[model samples]
Target: MQVAIDGPAGAGKSTIAKKLAAVYGMTYLDTGAMYRCIAHCVLNQGGNFENTDDIIRIAEKAAITFDGDRVFCNNKEVTEEIRTPLVSRHTSDVACIREVRELLVRQQKAYAKDHAVVMDGRDIGSVVLPDADFKFFLDADVLERARRRKKELDERGIVKSLEKIAQEINQRDDNDRNREEGPLIQMADAIVIDTTGKSIEQVCDAMRKYIDGAKA
Candidate 1:
């Protein structure tokens, strides 16, 4: 079974998906981290982000894996490394390539084939797992999303200007939505949840109710 959660940044997809996977005893896949892994390689190897071919090459050569909460690249632990400010700036670019998305999406689907998995990202519902057992599109006000992202960064000890983070959030949202191939969009059947004021448990509880009732 596949439960897909598609949403923009900081809408609590990662937090909710991880918890939901634990609840269902399913594998948790973070597709955003896959993009971050590619971006990390592009920047670390001095590859030009503007060169789509070069970025794709780096992505192909890079080995990305999620063993529970840990993210690895080329058999090395990069769980914390890719979440840096540098990777954040370049990840959008890396994710925009058609070839890269195709590559990663294929791998994600392959992993979900033999087991129940909860995968979360921008295009998971529309592109990666259209036949998912349950789909959700989580959204909140732009201000709320930015605030959540800022809080996360602050807690991680990554100091960044609020104005800059807000601008980047808007830019990424626009890019992800407007991209020609596999843009970030909600499937028509998706359950839309406005998580602006909801606690994590509240969100999970609602989803759990949906899952249990549907499978009952």
Candidate 2:
């Protein structure tokens, strides 16, 4: 009973996935955090990110563990640390590497082997869990997505210019779409849900109904 939620950043995939997992009494896996953990390590060690080989080695040696909503890197709790702007910029770069993607995708699959898991990421449906019992691709307009992200950052007391944030997101979208390995894409069988004006609960309820029908 795996539910794979694939979507771009700030589309509420994380919030929806967590609620969905709780509804199903399943663990929630955030695949992006795995790359963030690796990127954090590489940056912390003063390694050159441009050197893909070094990043790969760092990724292979790093140990990232997800326990509930918490994330541990090398046995140290780093759930919040990896979400910093520095790590955010580097994570997609790390995720683009074939070796790292293979490693993390394997880890993600292993986490869902027991089933009854809710996993969310850009490529979960198209790449990681194509056969998941329920698959959904969440999306929203670019401006709406940026607004959501701005609100989250505002809550954290980290103020970023909207112009800069929009630029970054657009660039990321391009890279995510063009990446050779596990690019962000909508699977043909995925149920596309536009979340432009919907609240988190509204989106969750819709998915719940879909899941219930599938189960029925």
Candidate 3:
């Protein structure tokens, strides 16, 4: 079955999606990683995020592929490159560009044509996979999201204070919601799951229960 999980930053969508996908034998696609690749490539080319036309051109020429958890851009392993603070901050800008979103959204939809995938991103359910067999919107409070994001950065050797991370997370939330292209809004049919105060297993169990209940 095709599953689309959409949510704000640091909501644990990727982790939950991967585990659930493994349990059901579905392909796990991280659309955020695709945007990160775009951001990384454009920055490498010295392209500015404010240059919409240039960013669109760069995105059109970008080729991204994933091997398990690793990501590649134009045949170069960029898994670590894209997670840098520079790329992380600009990834949302790339995602918000209409033409950039058009290109990646097309690619994301094509993947679903040949495989059952569990795709997670800001607009997966609302735009990329509206007819997904299962749709979920996972979210948590800003503080919790900030804490999770800080931990992710710390593990990668990128040090940033909680207050700074929280500010960036909040700014991203505004950008995602206000963007004209594929704004991050929950779909009417999506199952909203509040992930605050929940462990990974607890969240996964809740998702699996939703599937079982729906199928029954």
Model 1: per-residue lDDT, tens digit, 29-69?
A: 98999999999998889999899999989989998987889
The digit string of per-residue lDDT tens for model 2 on 103-158 reads: 99999998789767899988999889988988999999888888888887888888
Comparison by lDDT, 1 against 2, better one: 1
Candidate 2 TM-score, true structure as reference: 0.97
After TM-score superposition, the amount by which residue 106's alpha carbon in candidate 3 deviates from its true location, in angstroms, is 0.7
lDDT of 3 by residue, 1-216 (tens): 899999999899999999998998999999999999999989999998889999989998998999988898999998888888788889888988888898999999999999989999989998999999999999999999999988888998899999999999899999999999998999999999999999999999999998989889
Task: Give the residue spans of candidate 3 off by over 4 A.
Answer: none
Lowest summed lDDT over 10 consecutive residues: which window, candidate 2? 161-170
In candidate 2 the C-alpha lDDT for residue 111 amounts to 77
Full-model lDDT for every candidate: 0.91, 0.89, 0.92
